[model samples]
Target chain A: AQTVTQSQPEMSVQEAETVTLSCTYDTSENNYYLFWYKQPPSRQMILVIRQEAYKQQNATENRFSVNFQKAAKSFSLKISDSQLGDTAMYFCAFVTSNTDKLIFGTGTRLQVFP
Target chain B: SAVISQKPSRDICQRGTSLTIQCQVDSQVTMMFWYRQQPGQSLTLIATANQGSEATYESGFVIDKFPISRPNLTFSTLTVSNMSPEDSSIYLCSVEVRGAAGNTIYFGEGSWLTVV
Candidate 1:
């Protein structure tokens, strides 16, 4: 079985600043995918970014980026220039190649303050 | 990215009554899934909606309690039977689209059900 662990329960960052959310997963399979999703009060699940296991280069989407370490099984999300709109619940997810089922972490509530 | 839509965005239902939520995708997809998210919690997989077949539910969920139907490749419905206060949560419909990046999962707006 695969499991995703998010150490941070809550996080806060000032507007225009940066915050990094930590995520780690345990999986024996070599081929898998990691993802970060944001859910605001609207109850919508928005995909922030994703990283493929085979890709050595980290994934970046504008202000959002991931630091993926395959050997350590660590995938951290860094949001630069955080804005008030970034205030939401962020979840880290892992999925293997064999199945499309996504294993999600407990989630970290992020609050961006002015 | 596939555009997913869910009906009954939010509803208040009575206990013991059943509510069915519909999901529609803009394009054909091979995989569709249903998820449940409690207040202030992460999303949990409820079942996998396969086209032209029965849905495969996850642990702690049953077919009688949460029956799902996927009539075609682009549509599915999930019915919650005998609702309770504990069933007051957000039900999300998701689909997987394989791209160069990988198999990415996209979700619908979600249906918020409050059982009173």
Candidate 2:
């Protein structure tokens, strides 16, 4: 069974600053995928970014990037030039190549202050 | 990205009752998924709804408890049978969309269920 762990329960960053959310997972499969999702007060889950295990280059989407260390099973999300709209509960997810299911981490609440 | 909508955005139901939530997508999709998010907890996948096939449920979930229907490529429904207080949570429906990274998933606003 694969399990995702988000160490930080909460995080806050000032506008235009940077913040990083830590996530780790336990899995035996070499081929898999990792994702970061944002859920605002509206309760809509939106994908922030995704990283494939086979790719050595980390995934970056505008102000969001991930530090994916496959050997250590660590995938951290870094948000730069944070804006107030970025304030939300961020979740890290893991998906294996074999199944359509995705295992999610506990989640971290991010507050971007103006 | 696919725009998804869920019906009965929220409802308060008595224990032992059943609630059916509908999920409609703006465009045809390959798959739909039902998930549960308990208070202050991570999202837990309940089942995968595939058109023309019986929904595949995850461990700890069963067809009897959470019956699903995917009549077409753009719509699906999930029913929580014999609901209890423990079942109080937000039920979300999602669709897998094509993206640069292969398949990307998007979710609806979710139907909040409170069983008392």
Best by TM-score: 1
Give the whole-model CA lDDT for all candidates, comma-separated: 0.95, 0.92
Clashes of each: 0, 0
Local error of candidate 2 at residue A38 (angstroms): 0.6
- Candidate 2 falls in which docking quality class? medium
lDDT of 2 by residue, A73-99 (tens): 999999999999999999999778677
* Tens-place lDDT digits, model 1, residues B18-46: 99999999999999999999887888999
Angstrom error at residue B80, model 1: 0.4
List DockQ, one per candidate, in order.
0.90, 0.75
Instruction: Give the local distance difference test score of model 2.
Output: 0.92
Displacement of the residue B112 alpha carbon in candidate 2, Å: 1.0
lDDT of model 1, residue B77: 96
Worst 10 residues of 1 chain A by lDDT: A93-102
